[model samples]
Target: MTSSADAPRSGPVSAWAPLAIPAFRVLWFAQLGSNIGTWMQTVGAQWYLVDA
Candidate 1:
């Protein structure tokens, strides 16, 4: 017998499910900001390494 997990998964073009929790929204934004800052630092470090 096939399990529910055997069903086809949605493709990337599918609309993303909404985040309903307020705490989740706040955490997601905070993590996004942190990730951007981390990426900026990484690029700066790589440039410095190449210049050295």
Candidate 2:
């Protein structure tokens, strides 16, 4: 099998870009912002867990 060094770089690293079309940009941004907010909440929970 080929090693990680042989991985293709020509394509996108994520499939998220297709949702960036003008009609979808607003909804996409809203969803992404909410996701980031949820991420922050999870991080806070982890921090508290580690501290305790």
Candidate 3:
């Protein structure tokens, strides 16, 4: 019997292959935007507190 190590591979797999899925892509961008907004709000709050 052939060993698993001897099996042929299609090629190198991409790290971003999961982003190809439509639902996952949308969720990922949504999360990214949310995180950016949160960060900006935190920074703005800090600046306002410091300036007051």
Which one is best on TM-score? 3
| Model 1 lDDT per residue over 1-52, tens place | 8898797778664343445568887888899999999999999999999999
CA displacement after TM-score superposition, residue 34 of candidate 3 (Å): 0.3
Please give the lDDT score at residue 3 for candidate 2: 88
Q: For model 2, give the 10-residue run with minimal summed lDDT.
A: 11-20
Per-residue lDDT, model 3, residue 26, is: 100
lDDT of 3 by residue, 2-50 (tens): 9986998689979998899999999999999999999999999999999
The alpha-carbon lDDT assigned to residue 28 of candidate 3 equals 99
- lDDT value, residue 21 of candidate 1: 61
Q: Clashes in each model (backbone N, CA, C under 3 Å)?
A: 0, 0, 0
Q: lDDT value for candidate 2?
A: 0.86
Work out the TM-score per prediction: 0.61, 0.54, 0.76
What lDDT does each candidate get? Answer: 0.82, 0.86, 0.96
Using lDDT as the measure, the top candidate is 3
Model 3 ranges with Cα > 4 A deviation: 1-11
Write out the backbone clash pairs for model 3.
none
Model 1: lDDT to the true structure: 0.82
